[model samples]
Target: MDRQTLDMEGARRGEISSASLQMGEDTIAVQCIATMSVESMEFSPWETATNKRAQSLYASFFVINLFFGLMALAWGGLFPGNGSSFIALVIGGVLTLLGFVLGIRAAMMARRMKRRQPYYRLVIGASDGRRIPLVDNNRDVLMRIRDVVRHKMDSGDREIRGDFDLDLDLVNLNLPTEAQKAQTLSRGPDIVPKSRQRETEVEAATAETESEVLFDQDAEIIRDAS
Candidate 1:
């Protein structure tokens, strides 16, 4: 049989295994093989709209606050009457400061959300043109899958015939050293009063027995010499 046919058979039988191997002193590579069907690909319109709406809301609030603050300050400066001028100035200053803080915080949140949002999703396209979702909502993973799909399409391979293997290289496995392992083992259980007493007694008995044996050996040697 041809190699393609063998691979196809393996995929159909779900015979692929996932494993991890140490590639270097600090690097490890994980290999996984799976049979998957790609249905369709599209960007998320809903997510884009939601992001834009949130950004707009924050921007609108900031602009409104800033405009009102400026107006209050202008009124206070243009028309100084009794204590009304002081009140207006204080209100305007507080509002402007609040608006500035809010604007900054909103901008930061929007940027963070944009970074986290996944723009693409993979769907299982059915014969009827219906698409079903697959995989988690992660932009990086989706981008990688998109690249693979594009490559396959560009190569004119329309059909997937066999098991697909994915190799992921990971750095800093963060494994413990031998000394760390020994320390961890040594601290396995706390020494209770009963256990501590038993250990001390065992040590004392062992030392006494050893000393008596040494004394007996010495006496035998002296008798022989005499």
Candidate 2:
């Protein structure tokens, strides 16, 4: 059989393995659905006690705070006047603070999700997609996936090539680079050095481009690495 047929057949028969190595550039915390049973889950050592504890805490806090915030907003709005206004203010303030905290947490979650789902769930004929994780530790993998999924992010590209749908949505898909020369006309000729500024701009522009990865594998995005 030809290579494509072999891959398809292998994927269908559950004998398929990685054909080539790929790096993931970005990730999102998805409600990652795999076929593992609860019976099987009880045995995996990788599901650490710490991770489960943290997830449980995060879930509990999210629900509790959400309930309180909604309750405050609903109950506080019922009253009127300066004294009542004071009560409403407190409720509003609490809710607002909660919202701000949640927003920050959401951002953090997105960041973490990106890291966790470094690769994707491969679904050749949908025996249920297995979580095919990225092999490389390099950050560029996610950068690639972000660019690919930006267009049809919501459906996770369900419409684009069904076989590749999950793979495409699988964040960290690095895009190919362009050969075109970048040409932009600024207001005036060179004045200040602005070396750092220029470099930042270049990085930003490249980040917007197909490849979008400006930093090398060694350049750090997450600073507090232990």
Report the alpha-carbon TM-score of model 1 versus the true structure: 0.35
Whole-model Cα lDDT of every candidate shown, in order = 0.50, 0.39
- Model 2 TM-score, all chains together: 0.26
Q: Please state every model's RMSD to the true fold in angstroms.
A: 21.6, 32.0
| CA lDDT, candidate 2, residue 215 | 43
- Indicate the residue-level lDDT of 129 in model 1: 44
Ten contiguous residues with the weakest lDDT in model 2: 1-10
Give the per-residue Cα lDDT of candidate 1 at 39.
33
User: Which one wins on TM-score?
Assistant: 1
lDDT of 2 by residue, 1-226 (tens): 0011112211111111122222232222222322211110112222444544554565566667767776666666665544665676577668657765765665554444333222222221113454433222223433343333333334444332211222233332322222122222433456666898899899888777735454433345545363
lDDT of 1 by residue, 1-226 (tens): 0011111111111111123221112111121212225433333322345566766777788888898999899989999975798999999998888888778866865665544322233333434343333333344543444344444445544332222222221111222355578998988977579988999999999999999999999999999999
